[model samples]
Target chain A: MSGVFTEEQEELRRYARQWLDENAPLEAVRKIAETPEGFDAAQWSELGSLGWLGIAVGEAYGGSGFGFMELAVLAEEMGRTLYPSPFLSTVVLGTWLVERLGTDDQKAEILPAVVRGDHRLAVAAGRAAVHDLVARRQGTDWVVSGRARFVLDGHTAHTLIVEAAADDGTRLFLVDGDAGGLERNPLSVMDLTRPQAEVTATDVVASPLGDGRAGDAVDHALDRAVAALAMEQVGGAQACLDMSVEYAKVRHQFGRPIGSFQAIKHMCADMLVGVESARSAAYHLASVIDHDPEEAAIAAPVAKSFCSEAYEKAAGDTIQIHGGIGFTWEHDAHLYLKRAKSSALLFGDPRYHRAVLASRLGIE
Target chain B: MQVVVCVKQIPDPSGTYTLDPETHFLVRPDEQVLDDTDRYGVEMGLQIAQAHGGSVTLVSMGPKGSMQGIRQALAMGADRAVVVDDADLKGSDALTTAQVLAAAIQRTGFDLVITGTESTDGYSGVVPQMLAELLDVPALTYATEVEARDGKVTINRQTSAGYDVVEASLPAVVSVTAGVVEPRYPTFKGIMDAKKKEVEELTASDLGVDTSLRQRVTAVEPAPEREAGVKIEDDGEAHLKVVELLQQKKVI
Candidate 1:
């Protein structure tokens, strides 16, 4: 517990650090943020070629069949560089749900395409979807109507995995993004790095992934997504800490390095502590998810609650460390801050996670 | 076409290396940093193994920390690993390290052995050569590119003038220069796969290498801090000032 990464995992961290330095440089991220999909096909395809999208999926579905640890390992790196990709949405959320709960035919249809980067998909969690969106029986096919707000990568996804309110309680359905009655309006989000949208499904034909029982599947998918995002937050904190420390070293004040000052040193030290704390929690979540699913339930909420705020605090201090320059639109610090803010509230706020943690602890 | 890659684990040079103020020895941190130079050899080994239809075995002889580097190589798709670790091996010189590595590789069974030109901690590039001599194989050092086919290997030995194409038969050792091929990033799946991969552990007695009286570091000293140079303003007499300063420092 003293160190967050294992020897083999450290190898992944090094590899990812170098790869992100070369491929997902800050300038490229800034540029990519302006693109229609917020990520180009080539870059996404390149990640696919690297077998990233299939990290946790089974080999039968064209994945390498690793566990949550491997996924978190990459997620942290992706967050460090603010890598603008659909990895979190597609792999962590969408592909995860499909592979874990989808029928054999369902997995056969979607997972391989996701592995090859041929398909870009997203999940609108049933709990997150507006209750007005209802599933109705239309002859042999099911039709979904109403709205799914805050769908990650909703506009760019070729396919949508939506949780609809049906007679069978909350059910999960997969539908074409361009389904006749579906309208996707991309939201102007603060974190340009990760895009989102609102999907209005009016009589959109839907296919149930399996029995469509939301049950614990949605929670499991969300827990997986939260744990993965927690890693990203810790990573963002690491990035901010590195930047602040570097800036503190060179940015002198009173004819001396600011890093030499007690205030700056304490701030930097606190940032380090914050990041390492969140990192440990997130790593514990991943380890538990892989080894003990029941334990993952307890760890995920703590990870989410702590990590979201840690990233925000770390990013905020990063801007403060840079003084006036960090406030400018041209600088990268604001982008991180924005990402921290949006990510804090993406799945649910710290209050929500804390509530979840409290309930799990039987303290509610 | 089984390839064996020799790797060394070093503390991150970017971080401060503290001295065990009580003892004069450098207090090694628990941090695990793979020698950046060795990545090229790992990449080359994997490429050869993939192209020739065989596995790449990684052999490392260092502290337990060496598993950090070995695990990294395995994550990059090396088949398995052999770690020869013992507390007695500390302060052993290049020759001692090469002996342990040679013994480990003998057990691993490799047609070709790959190593970085030098390690970060000890830039003594002599170990690979010593390893080759111990194994009784041709040593190709500082190769910019390596190709394997038909029980033979060819390497482009880098030189100031140009690279020299050298061919060695199978069962050879090649020290690869960095930038042969961009080492592939260890995918998440690969890292997980590596965790399940077998790691054959060996010790001093297992390797039958007497580690007690080998070449030991007599003393360790940090490099002297560089003195700040005197800067002369760009006045008419700045050139004269430069000359005076140079002569004062005995450059004349």
Candidate 2:
């Protein structure tokens, strides 16, 4: 049997596609890029109205009562259209952590707003792209003074979910974005489509989430997040290859379509191979994230590593295929390149993920 | 609020069709495809159903291959599909096709029906009105904006003069125009799920409609090939070239 999605997933795909076609087409994407904030407020509000931003949130909290796979489908479409939103942060990380680890009151209060797209949240796990859950708690008012850089959508997020030490126990804290002791500044990054930021926390107003019990849940969610991000990266990389192939076909040189040449054809073919392989890995990872985290953890790195390089190679070759035109500022090829690089680094880059996989597999 | 969209899966008109120059007519030796306008119709149906909380059943009158377009509709959020397929009904024109579909609508019993104003291939822009006449229900054509409230349907129709706001009673047939909304790309998951959505197969006999029609393809002629002629050098030259081309064509 082929690796086709199940019947329910197909239904979700239909709904997602319909929504995206109307709400986020190429022209909508252009409009977003032209905006100063790079976000279409009306579009985001519409997505909220459709219950898309909260696909994974529980029904009690104003979501569509779907699973992570549904959210993963939305993420894939978002990646395809290069939709700029803090979906991964607020929906995936913030809501996941709060729902699984926060106090019941917190869940009741915060989860609903997160689902409504009214509350945008970010996470600060500290300097490293990848880190083990480690925290040191202070007194009753836990002061989490650490550094978390390159946080996705961190610059504009309303709240920061910080990983801090609580009595030598790993803990999650809800740190106020505008807290007096905390500082966050946007970073100059390659991916202009989605901004990244470096955050510094001092003795900030912190509320411990599930105290020490949140560690295991946070770790589990992180694994799923990694897998989800890897899947999105694969989608983005696949799109980059597709755009390049499409461009190569129409562009003419020496009285023939450039795609007719063996060199460009070979490049496209190779990119296809990489994309297909990465897709298999990414889809398999998404398929297993709920049931088999260990396997998903292993597959996540493989997909990310392969896709990270595949996209970079494909993006560079796309520029090469278009020659001077692809290199120009007006062209959109470079935007994909930036996104590919940024997505590769998020949730651990190819190298970092590979190393984690090596340890998990006992490879060395 | 049940909204029925009548969509026809015609060949894509935007692209060049396969042809046998020797015979001098369009040759569809391969598979036939649906028009883009019909896709927007399907999308609009889905949108109305989603907003109004009702069902959308996609109905079509064509061969078995046209089931693909119905399935595409199902994937886009239609509750089900009803395809009226028949061998003797092969050469039915727009009027006969609409009659058969109207019969299907009579059987299905929908609150509202939707369709493209015109298929890209046939460019008839007549099916919705034909269906409305057959069904004896009020109709709205070329609807760009539609709202249903208190069993009344209000529509904004695109007209040569401007947009006309038209309202009708509970049950109606609507024909959508081009550029209404973007048709969705079928996701991998949707394709898998659409297989399970009930796609009831119907025929002309099933609808109890006669297949006989006066319209037939007597002698096909290739549409005149459009030529690319004008080449404007720069901004100033573009204006001059435009005037020159218009003068040559006697348009200005």
Candidate 3:
């Protein structure tokens, strides 16, 4: 029977699952999460060497030259493992923005480094409908001033792509991480696997990403990022369901396994429905985004909204199913719960995306 | 060096299995995957080919439409594959399998042959040796580590106590053990490129091999279900009860 994914994609999924199971198990994730950087440089380089860091990058830029579908598979696997890395910030947001809007010279210089895992990138843009940073033309340069909150991996990125309001329209500017007038404070985030930061730019000298307005390009990149994040949510929801089912089968109470109970069985069954539905939505969005940009505009918000709620409900139900053990700090359930909550709020929460979807469908 | 790795497509070990009552053979599931043990041999072959400036080829003998597992191994960087698929091969013994594989290997022209010590489902553990004997080459079994240089193959053969360093000339068969070397995951490029790689399919008649079975299963029986063990709840004198039970079963 034919499936939504290709055989090659399925093989990629298996390969990724096996690699993550060995290299980034829960123990390694916990160790990396506890570190201040919240990422392991060695592991990041290893991922680059394995060609995972460049799955979606063009071959001209020293990447694998595959499309976003392969990236979705990698993202799902990363989410399943709770892999502690700046992949979203660096690969999804930063590199995409540059590749979408950067000049040929910029792409030639920066993308190779990003693919090699030698340089990291972050986008200093707040939530949708919000533009905090402002840029003004200076002598042969642009000076940016504003505070952008919830900047994913902002503190450790080698370069920062700051979305700022210009005199004519909104624009994207590239600033060095250690620019003289820039300050980044890492936030104490709920999701330990993904780090966020507050970036304050006080007249940081920057270079314009492209010669003109960047609103459309930024929106396209955001749509792609939302689709990618939805795929991750699907993986997280599936993992929560798997953990619940496995636990229910082994944990006995009152001389019978909890899974044998109708109530527990129903809960597990509901989780399965949510996870599979979310997976369908996410996979559909990934394909549309690769093939048709017009279809992707509508599919992105639908997937984002559905997957966010699915993951949130699955994570919450996972905790309830496990009873007291799931509540403890030692267990891995809370980690996923935190990830679910944080990821739902990352690009935009379910409510926000639902509104976006309604407007896109001309219902609002 | 032209390294050839013998791979098998077996039903997923995670799936439930049953024996066909009348035929006394395994009712193989629709889902099949590359045997876990053979992955080591493929990885070893790839490493040898990479270091010695050659390409690795995969050879397998199984029912038709079992190419999914072969495709998986190809995605792991094998240059090409040859599959011996024919209906007549059903219930073929290990020796018959070796004969068919030897023909395919000869057609592919291999300087060295690598295989897993045993297939997971059958556990015959004799196909590599049989192939070696049929092809008139020295067999090196249970290799934990293998090296090819100077027109010879050297291996650290695994044993119950320790490993033995064994060496043989070119055109040898070596069976590698699990954990010999970590298998590399297929990269996206590798997966995409595998689609265009060559997969030559042949039948038993084309290979000039007889499909008659030398060994066959006469009867099949399900293993007896395990009985529940006696449970002794913890009490103040639970240790004494446990000791008494152990003494009743055997002397403490």
Candidate 4:
């Protein structure tokens, strides 16, 4: 079937498929997931050299001058295979936010390095509710003291964006992992593949991205990030549903394939509905983020709510369809289920996003 | 040095080519490309120009719609492209097309020219020799291995029986068969770069070439349907049918 892409976009799709078949095979993904850093540096560098890392960045910043549509295509492919890399953290969140909020010097110094895949960044946005309400400050230098919990890949990132309280408002402060008075510790998470951590800052040295209106910039960045994550969730959930349907077609019960049974068929059909609905919401959210961020801010939470629920339902449905073998520790179904839950809560849980949607729309 | 590669866009030949019952002409979609065999010629010319530190210009003669073939050649590493588009040039026989191509090549003062031995449609495979005669230059046909070094040329030509390796000088034309090098797929970046490439268009008036050829497409009709052969279930049955058919035709 034809996708909603031009011939130029189709060329990129073909190139990416061929490149992955040749370079980033299943064995490569497996080996990288087994590594300490949980990503293959050499393969990341290869993608960077191939100009994929800069597909959406501006040409003035050494990018291809494309848009988020192209990046979304690549991200969906990555999610299809559960690519084991910090690509989401570095490429989607880190590089995207830096491009939007960084100073000219910051853009010149940091954008190229990230484009070259020399450094990785993880944003420490999710934290205790108290820190989210306001920012704290000190005498000559601003001292941000707070703990950010549930930071995605927080331990592995070289640079961290620590959301803090300032005298003016809530602001995002840049903190190095190895900076003085910063404590980085891993959290025991359900998803083993993508690790999370809690970061504590006690007078940590940080450079404020901007002096004023940093909160709004970071808030807009988070909205876009949530939209991207929703798209990835749709891909993951769809992959799970696909795998489950394939398994049902082969696995037999009472001398007949289970997929022929009405119960199994109905379950699979419901999963399809959830996946397609999530896809529609996710795609709609992506379309609005570029042209209209305010509308995107409202649509993003709605997509986040739907996608978070869809992935969790799809993952559970996939495990149930696999029956006895799925309950075993060796089975991979549980891994996907764990990832679904963890990913759903990465930016905001469905409930948190529902509340945000209600407040944004002035609906009580 | 300026090298020219003849590129023709034909329908994707890998798919089944069927004749319409109403039109005997080849059924081609309104799309263009560097014909499969001509892509090898273009790649070979690019290699020669790169080794000789010269320039390779791709030339394609078809409707203005055929400039897509030239752009594809440029993305395949050709330096530039020229297109000869004319309404009168359409439906010209092999001899007439060769005469116009010779005029276009002469306009550029090309040092060397390369082309496919045959187009998927025409299959005449006579343009190189015909153009060579018009230009009065040495022409080598069915070249499998071509080498150009220090202004000298050598080619291995495939003949009906065996092969003939011959030596030539500069300012020659070579029509190629496949087995030069596998054509390269355009990189993700090359698609973007091809948009900036320049393709010049020339008409028959610009070339001062006359369209007084004897043969022209007066009419077109579809050929008859090809019959599907009977499937033999076993090797013995296939051998017996083959022998019987040959015997009935009085072959042996």
Q: Give per-residue CA lDDT, model 2, range A165-268, as digits (tens).
A: 66655677787778887787777767766767778776677787765356456656777676667667666777778888888888999998999999988988
The list of candidate 4 runs beyond 4 A from truth reads A1-7, A126-146, A183-188, A250-257, A323-335, B1-252
Better of 3 and 4 by lDDT: 3
Q: In candidate 3 chain B, what residue range of length 10 has the lowest lDDT sum?
A: B23-32
Highest TM-score: which candidate? 3
DockQ, structure candidate 2: 0.23
TM-score of chain B, per candidate? 0.86, 0.82, 0.88, 0.82
Query: In model 2, what is the error at residue A294, expressed in angstroms?
Result: 2.0
DockQ of candidates 1 onward, in order? 0.43, 0.23, 0.65, 0.17
Residues A155-272, model 1: lDDT tens digits = 9988888887888687888999888999998888889998888888889999987877767878888888888899899888999999999899999889999899898888899999
Q: Which order, best to worst by DockQ?
A: 3, 1, 2, 4
Candidate 2 global CA lDDT score = 0.74
Candidate 3 docking class = medium
lDDT of 1 by residue, B1-252 (tens): 889999877878778777655544456665656788988999999999899899888888777664666677778889988888888887677888898999999988889999999987778889999999999999998899999999899999998668999999989999999898788777766777888999988898898987865554556677999999767789698998888887877777
Per-structure clash totals for the candidates: 0, 11, 0, 8
True contacts kept of each: 0.76, 0.14, 0.76, 0.10
Model 4 alpha-carbon miss at residue A167, Å: 3.9
Off by over 4 Å in 2: A1-4, A7-38, A126-139, B1-3, B9-57, B64-81, B110-112, B137-140, B144-157, B163-172, B178-200, B219-222, B228-252
lDDT of each: 0.85, 0.74, 0.88, 0.75
Model 3 residue pairs with clashes:
none
lDDT of 2 by residue, B1-252 (tens): 787787766554546766545533344422455556777888888888888798988888777563555676776667888888787676678788888999998998889888888776666678889899999998888888878768888889987657999999978887877777776555443555678899888888888888876675656665699998756688656888888888877777
> Candidate 1 DockQ score?
0.43
